[model samples]
Target: MVRGLTVLCWAVATPGLLWAAVRLLGVERGPLVQLLAFTPYVAGWSLLPVALSLALRRWWPAGVAAVAAVALIAVVAPRAFGGGSPAGGGGPTLRVLTANLLAGAGDAPTLVRLVRERQVDVLAVQEFTPEAAARLDASGLAELMPHRRLNPVAGTEGSGLYSRFPLTATGVRENPGGFTQAYGTLTAPGAAPATVESVHPAAPYSLGQLRAWERDLDAQPRATPGGPIRILAGDFNATLDHAPLRRLIASGYRDAADATGAGLAGTWGPYLPDQRHSSDRVPAIRRMAARITGDRIPPVTIDHVLVDRRVGVRDVSVLRLPGSDHRPVYAELALPRAELGG
Candidate 1:
């Protein structure tokens, strides 16, 4: 009985310990890349191993499980309570909204409505399609956000950046993952120029795409502290828990969601992986049905608004967009004054 109890305790406890190590040491690879997206959920479950080991009087496993639980919690807890930067009272405020259109299947009218109602100053879209672009413009997005740099194409390869302010030095760059990202220098009146991009690094949808995913994230442009403010917003396809994303954020940028303590909120997939980006054509009823049944599958935070560390993050919220698998992340940021040259 003691041997059986030891086996049971070790079974659960060992996996938690492994998860904690890989997460902290940034050693995740292949399928683990995809799996680590659920680290927040795993963090909560880590406690179970500790309890089991302790209750079974398995002293060795108990110590190990306790360490794992503490480590995982330490990794996840801060995101729930980070020090939010104060809004720059008199500085220019840029309200950013980012979403993945799921290959243009996200509702055009609803996306437009979000921009209008939220008074969004900049909008970054991923998985953008030419058809979706036309639909959005026709639905009055062009009027709301007149300035734009769009790379709308067929399928999920497109991205776009739309702003109310003028855009300069705009272009679309294709990442190693074959996704085109739209970028531009946004010059809002009375504020410093911001180089913003609609970022969509490759998702590690399969083990085959894992390397591509890492390369894409590694290639993201870093912010220079004394340079023009940079904001990278869209479906990053990575969460704060992922190592590559964390490394990129460490490079002079702060995730608006993390800065505002909304980091743990899920933005993608309460849907199955296969259904997460399915066509937007599925009727509203069916979509709701999937979500209701998918309550057991916890979503992950992959969409983000990463601003220059110097920028102030006033607020962050994850909002529902009915037709898309991903939720839109809206962040209100205060850009530094023009005098503070980079």
Candidate 2:
């Protein structure tokens, strides 16, 4: 029993250690390395091995696991607890909400409720299909958000932006792989007009997709400090762990969730339970598996709201939407009076 347990301890600890090393070494190059970039974001799972090692009284293995956990925490903790931009002098607050409709599977009623309840000033939707656009129009969203820009595509690459404030469609960026991002300027009362973009980069599921994803991210206009404030929000399909996103953030923009210490929150997964597994036995086991593995397939923070550092992020929150695989991310931002020369 002791020897078997020792083997098990090594089995778990080795992978954790290897992951930690890879993460710290920044080994991103090939397809596998690119996939490994996402590992640190889910590093919370490392604690499972740590807990097991401690339970088995395996100090050395426990130490190794602990190191792995510590490494992950070191990478992620800053975003969760780091201080954000200081409060700007009194100015108009802009409430923005971003959601990925999962190819228009988002619930119309829920979306309307969120817009009304949150008093959202700016709304951005990804995967905005024509059907979803029609539903949103019928749901009285237009009444609340009078100004709008809708780029309804045939498939999941569609995107849209709606605003209570006046919105002017600026341009649309189309990337390889059919991914589309919509851009607009929102003119809010008593505040300088800010550029807002609804973005949806392609998923990095393959080398081709990964390169396209990087290109899309790179194509996103960088925010200039002390310049016009820009809000980029939607399903980036890449996390802070991705070099492209990290570089983007380092270039004078800040993720709302990270700015507000909500960076650890997951916005994807726990999708409407699979009907095939709806039976009690299968569903329960699936749920158990999800719990055990952190639902790698279902749970991650791929959706985000990124704003210029000059924009004060007051708060950030996530809400589950019916029929969608992703949660809506809302951020309350305040534009500084000085930025607009108010």
Candidate 3:
């Protein structure tokens, strides 16, 4: 009986050890991509296996579980505490916000109210529809953010950018992932010019689209340390745990949420009991992922605002609105000197 119980402890620790291996190696593929988003939760539970093995007086299982627990904690613990790079060159603070409106269905007044209350200087929007654009305009979005470059269509492919500052060299480009990305050069007074892109990468909904999702992430331009300051903001459909996003960040961008220790806040699936998940309209994979994560929060932080490393991150927060699964991500950034972007 003792031997059988020890075997059970080994079984419990094995999956977590595999998870740690996949995460550490960045080898998670297909549906595993969705599951890897739950790394933080798994890291917390890893302690249980260690305790159980030790209590059962099984040294081998205990050692393995302790190794897995340490590895998981090393990967996940840093995000919960703040100590991001202080790279700002002492320029003006730029308040930026990004949100995905869920195909014209998200509440427009609430978005406008967030902008008004938050004093957002730049706003990046994904899943923007023409009707939603008109609704936002009707709700007095133009009064707050007069300058704009929008490509609002009827479906999830549309994207847009609105700013209090002027936008130049503005255009909409269809990314390989089948989403329209709105981008432009933003000129803020007393600070350098920043090129901002509204990002909406293809979600790896199925095994077939996985390549497309990878292409989308790969196509996202890396931050140019020697060139213009850049900010990529919106529903990336990928999280910090993903390898491609990690590569993107390594190329010179800083995740606002991760910088401020809000990285663990679930951004995608609130995963409630009610049919309220009905409103979010996520695909079967996400719903399954919700179940895998115990159908509660559903390991997710897909929406992000990644800024150039030259900028200093002051604060990051998440805000909610009705009818959208993704909440708005707001970041307070201090841009570098005016010449850094030139």
Candidate 4:
């Protein structure tokens, strides 16, 4: 019994150790390897092996698992609990909200209510469908946000940006895989106009999709700290653990949630029912199970509000939106006085 238990402990510890090594090495070549990039997002699962090793009194295996947990914690803990830069002294504050409409199925009235309640200055939406756009327009959002740049597509590729300030449609960034992103300049009253992009990279579900997602992320323009203050807000389909997003951050952009110590809050999970299931009853059951289990699928933070270093992220929060799998992310930002067109 002792020997068998020891073998079981090793079996549990090896996989986590290997995954930790992969993350440390930053190897994202094939589909399987690319999937490993998300291991850190679910790093909490590593504790299972540690618990097992401790129960079996296997110190070496327990130590190995503990090290694996520590390594992952080292990677994620700073973002989860680290200190952010102090808020800038003088500048106009802009409150921005971003949401994925779940292919236009999100509740229009609920969204409008959020905008009004939060006093959002800029709103960015991904997976915008024409019907959803129509509903949003009719919900009095247009009156609140007169300046708009909408590119409503058939499916999940559509994107839109609305602002209380003036907006000039720059262009639509259409990926080869049919992923469309809309960007424009938002002219605030006292601040120099900033470029804002509604970002939604392709989901990396398979090898081809992974390649496309990588391409989409790599194609994003880098932010120039001293130049125009740029904001990229939407569902990135990649997390901080991904190498491409890390590179993007290294290029002078900062995630608003991270800046405000809200990075640990998850925005994506199994809240919405899976529409792909053949039977409606199955989806209902699945949702019920998820609710009962407290959504044990291990939620991930895929949606973000990224801004240039010159912008100060004063606060960040996440809201649950009806009819959507993702929670809406809102951030209050302040630009430096020099960038305020003083």
Candidate 5:
């Protein structure tokens, strides 16, 4: 009977331990498995083996407990070391819009219409191609957004900024080809000079890329323009679940949507196996719905608009936009009266 109980515990514990080990060793992929690095799931998995050993009054439980504790520690160590800031604080009011154009999936007109309707103050676009830029220009975007910045000219990881206020192109890098990872000055009519950083870190195909991007964001220089507000916006390609992202939170950047309880706005690959695809001529719309509903696996939030603590964000939302694999994130930031000098 004792042997049987021990076998039962081993049966449950071994697989959990192996899975945890694999993730820790970087043997697995995807955002879901990454959580084993810090989530509480590891503790529950390690407990059964410990209980079995304790029942027999053996030294094995100690071993089990030590291993389990280590796994838990690896997953949560970043946070313990002060990796993220408080939920939401600091910064003046700044409205923001972020979207990935998906290299012109034939939804430009609709997307332009949405931006005009929403009256988005600052717009950031990734994967923006020159053709899309032409389309946007034809749509009179230049009139609405007088100031603009473009990087990578027109391709993947390419970024651009369009704002109602005039943009002073400072700190432009030519090899990353004039893509100012840091750009934009606020021209919101008597508001402070806010600096906006538009970043699209290199996606992690391997552990190295992932780690580099993490450090890049963590160490990304901060620019203060005599303004109480700072804004960071773009396709991080990383989620809140990761260790590096926690550090961004620690740095006092406010995640607008989560702060306002806007729900998990996952912007990535769309289409579930069970999902029925529409025959509509526009693939962008069909795909956008697939992304929201998570027709395949669960949705993940990759794109984001993070604001500084002094800014009070009233609302944040996901909007369906044409010509992109990802939807646009819109946020309404409320400026403090003192910051506004009102």
Candidate 6:
């Protein structure tokens, strides 16, 4: 009877454990609330499974182990194959990259290196400084990409937009707190007009600040003079599972990265390298290292490139760039010509 009961408890908790793991992967959607939603799942799988195994020390414990393994496997599968290339047919695809440069953090060289390697078509940078901007310009990135919009905030942590196509200044608006959010009209070679907003909003860590940021985003007008093919990129400082993120989605924006299934790609919290650290700190730093290596919160993803639902994403990636705590997020979106009403 004791052994049977243990097996039952194990079976009951297995699904929850699986859910917790999956929740952990998807937790960044809501940094404060939904992020904590999987706490029960972690407790059940991490502690309860071992406790049940010990209590029910018997032949059936083997069955419990099997169930646990199956549960874990099920949770990780979505992140693995979720963002593959579309099966049969698709339209012209454009690669978009978004990065929070951490005020340049001595990472200009690496950023330049990544740009060349990735062949990024459209680049959105947050926390940009004039010096860093000059460094990128010196690297000849501005010449290579050509089309650009640089916010004149003149700080280490400002925002800017760059593209491989021609650009015309559409509008520029500063939030009430003075952060510059620039919107530009990009004329890609053959695609429809894309209204890209390079925004660097204040981190809405508190309830009051979050509400303000939410209000500010709501005020930004949608794409004009063409169909509504919009791209909101930069360091949003809010997670998707959060209320603000929910609002954006419900209001018709889709996370190009997450929607294309790049849920496991975490892009924040000190993944960069420095010469000062000893090898011991490196070895002992499992949790931080895991967040970087594991690519999930515990590393947060305050940086994003979200598109309206009308667009289709072909590929999404997080570039492991040096200098910033956050990685550069990349998305390949296929905006069908037919979808535009010109």
Which candidate, 3 or 6, would have the higher lDDT against the true structure?
A: 3
Q: What are the lDDT figures for the candidates, one per model?
A: 0.87, 0.78, 0.85, 0.80, 0.60, 0.62
Q: Per-residue CA lDDT of candidate 4, range 1-342, in tens?
A: 989999999999987787777677766667644465457554778899999999989999999999888887777777676357534525778899999987787778889999999999999999898888899989989898888888998668899988888888577888766778888888666776788988998888667687788888888878877577788999988877778887887788899998778888888876565323322222244446546765555677899999887777888999978777789999988866644431
Off by over 4 Å in 4: 29-41, 54-57, 86-90, 274-296, 339-342
Question: Which pairs clash (backbone N, Cα, C closer than 3 Å) in model 1?
Answer: 226-342, 227-342
Local accuracy of candidate 5 as per-residue lDDT tens digits, 1-342: 877766665665565566556545544455433443334445445666676666665455446555765675465344223223232324344678887666544366766777788887788876666777887889878788877776635446456778887776444332121223536666466455666767666555355455555556565534232444577777766665555665676676667766675535566545232223222322454455656766444445667777766556777778776445566788877644444521
The local lDDT score (0 to 100) that residue 241 gets in candidate 5 is 55
Model 1 stretches astray by more than 4 angstroms: 86-90, 271-296
Q: Which ten residues in a row have the lowest lDDT in candidate 1?
A: 271-280
The RMSD (Cα, Å) of candidate 5 is: 6.9
Per-residue alpha-carbon lDDT of candidate 3 for residues 240-277, written as tens digits (9 for 90 to 100) = 88998998999999888888888887777763222253
Better of 2 and 3 by TM-score: 3
Superposed by TM-score, candidate 2 places the C-alpha of residue 160 at a distance from the truth, in angstroms, of 0.5
lDDT of 1 at 60: 92
**What would the per-residue lDDT of candidate 1 be over residues 85-194, giving only the tens digit for each residue?**
94443578889999898778888888899999999999999989888899999999999999999999877899999999999999998999999899999867778899
Candidate 6, number of clashes: 6
RMSD vs true structure, all candidates: 3.3, 5.3, 3.0, 4.2, 6.9, 7.0
- Each prediction's number of clashing residue pairs: 2, 1, 0, 0, 19, 6
lDDT of 3 at 253: 91
Instruction: Give lDDT: candidate 4, residue 280.
Output: 29
Residue pairs with backbone atoms closer than 3 Å in model 6 (clashes): 29-240, 29-241, 29-242, 30-241, 30-242, 127-157
Residue 107 lDDT (model 4): 77
- Evaluation by TM-score, superior candidate among 5 and 6: 6
lDDT of 2 by residue, 267-297 (tens): 8756645323322222244345446655446
What TM-score does each of the candidates earn? 0.92, 0.83, 0.92, 0.87, 0.67, 0.69
Candidate 6 residue-wise lDDT, 165-242, digit = tens: 777866666776457776787766656667888777666645556556666656555433235567888777665534
